[model samples]
Target chain A: MTLLEDILLLGLIVTAVAAPLCKRLMATVIVYMSFGLLMAVLWVLLESPDLAVTEAAVGVGVTTILFFLTLRRIHELKGTKDE
Target chain B: MSKKESAWTRFAAWVNGEHEPAESRLFSMGMGPRKERRPEITLPKREEKQRLHGFLSWYPVASAVIGVILVGILLATVLAMPSFGQVENPTNNEVPAHYLQHTREETGASNAVAGMILNYRGFDTFGESCVLFLAVSCVFILLLRDENNTSQKDLEQAQRREQRRKRRQDVILQEAARLLSPFILLFGAYMLLGGHHSPGGGFSGGAVLGGALILYASAFGQDAIRRFFNEKVYNTVRVIGLMLYAVLFGYYIFTGANGLENHIPLDYGGLILPIDIAVGLVVACTMYGFYAMFTRGEL
Candidate 1:
């Protein structure tokens, strides 16, 4: 369990630093969403399932959608050939 | 003399105190009126321009470096803190002890957290609902569009975009949304109603409900959602949810503060359930309202 927590904490730090470093806006949003996922896991490990659920829903789910919508609106996601 | 030389001569004359400052006169002596007196902007030399462009290209990298350093500092600070759930931790105070010991009896909630938020500190939850309400209202003010605000060309462009999307409909997303929305909505309701006895509560459950709504909206388009969740219904739900919480919690505070027992047979569990539902409604509306206002600018 300690090992898993250590790995998760490391992942959290990596994602937190990598999000802003991503060149593409899409990659940045995805990295940030992953950071949220790791935080949710941390919350669960800390025995606060209430916070875990809220974090997953608000952080990973709604906020990511909102970010994608804003990106699309600003035309930052245009001309992608990635079918 | 050229314009620059004459302006310099006028400045030297003014410094000598030969006459009045000639502020208005000198300003009016430009090519035309004050508004049209444009200053000549010279571009930087080649080397300076190159340096500026290089700096511009490196700005993002510099900011990213600063961000990483800040994150490192924060991580170091967090790592140095006490571990979670330690008995000697500062958070292991009498306040939590009291809440854990007496929450079930006083609030009739199996979940101490739900009891804490919805019963003991219900006014705080009510304030959060008000914040959500005000947030959606602000978004509506900033983003909601109607015939007056939307232009004909914008409407045409939107229609064209919708048509293009309809032409290239993502069948997989639509199918998944159709298959999943019902279960998602059911789980959200369960979380909301069972909040007092479970780990879930209004915020999470309402967020899940909002996520389901957003998925359905994305797959089925605005017209389909507007059939049931029109602007009128949205406004009514948001306003009614906040008002209900305010009135009920206000009554509770008044009665409790006055040291008067309730005439009604409503128990703590009943009060918590209603407040949870009210909060759920406000949060669900806020999430969906933000999505709708951001995307379609109408709901």
Candidate 2:
């Protein structure tokens, strides 16, 4: 990998690990989004445009929306003291 | 040494074409080279094993060490891989060439990937359709609330709260969603129906459709879309999509692709467009259903 690719990959790994470990639920969700974006970039770097498209669509788009929807539902019920 | 030869042989595993089903392998092959028993080691008693396990689990340092070792091994494997787009790479072989060269002529689809999914590996696409159908079913079963079990008073309270919540949501966002929703659905349809000649296919088009539906529902409230595409209507669409794919394949099996006399009888030669739409429908429903059931706990 080039220096740029290597740095991006390291950032990707950090985001992946940090997502679950993040204290705040919202922060965790944002970190997961960051991880997905990074993964899409990595897929592009690996010369798999189709995979990059899929990762962006499903991983970043649909999944993040799902997470946000769930979070909203939780906020509706619990009145958000922020988990 | 023979060990080196054996290692090289094992490394080129795909060259051996070990593509048989698991059951067939177990029955016919009789474990082949693995028939030789592994060296036996005596097992400790349960109490002793538990004590040892507890002792090992006491230190997080051991876990860290194991993780580092695993990373190191994986890094080595990555480093040893051939450079991307190299001529000598195993993936640079004949199979991809065959697909790329003959895809248009063989399948009537200009897009190689689309042709491959809907033609060459058509059955795999059929399986994917079923999987998407099953996914929606699972989510429905898990999240759909049992209406009869809930008290009438509780239901009224929930409905009142939902309406209050809906009123509180931003109208500007809803207006924007309203403006954009039709365009989104139109684009998704174009993607799905025109997939054979373009980059977009069922998966991407379905994702777009799902996004459009979600956007529309969020903007107009579930009641708006629900009026037209209620649960019964959505279920029918989903089932029809899956059934068409299944029936298409069944017809292919029964009469063959070119019909009984091995010649094109009617204009029903390529099923790529229909199959793509079918898969797209299932996927779109899956995404929409999961959202509906999860967020509202019913659909």
| Candidate 1 wrong stretches, greater than 4 Å | A79-83, B1-83, B257-268
Error of 2 at B297 (Å): 2.7
Q: Write the per-residue lDDT of candidate 1 for residues B1-299, one digit (tens) a residue.
A: 69999888878776554545646676444565457667887777997899899999999899889978998999999999998789999999998998898777666688989989988888788888888888888898789887658999888877887897899999999999999999999999999988988988889989999999999999999888999999899889888888888888888887772224554333546577888888998999999999999988888
- Per-residue lDDT, model 2, residue B229, is 87
TM-score against truth, every candidate: 0.82, 0.75
| C-alpha RMSD by candidate, in order | 12.7, 15.0
* Tens digit per residue, CA lDDT, model 2, A1-83: 69879999899889978987888788898899999999989988887655776677678878988988888767842464332
Model 1 per-residue lDDT at A70: 88
Model 1, A18: alpha-carbon shift in Å? 1.6
After superposition, candidate 2 runs with Cα above 4 Å error: A1-10, A41-47, A72-83, B1-60, B255-269
In each prediction, how many residue pairs overlap at the backbone (N, C-alpha, C within less than 3 A)? 0, 0
Across all models, the iRMS values in order are: 0.6, 1.5
CA displacement after TM-score superposition, residue A9 of candidate 1 (Å): 1.7
lDDT of 2 at B160: 80
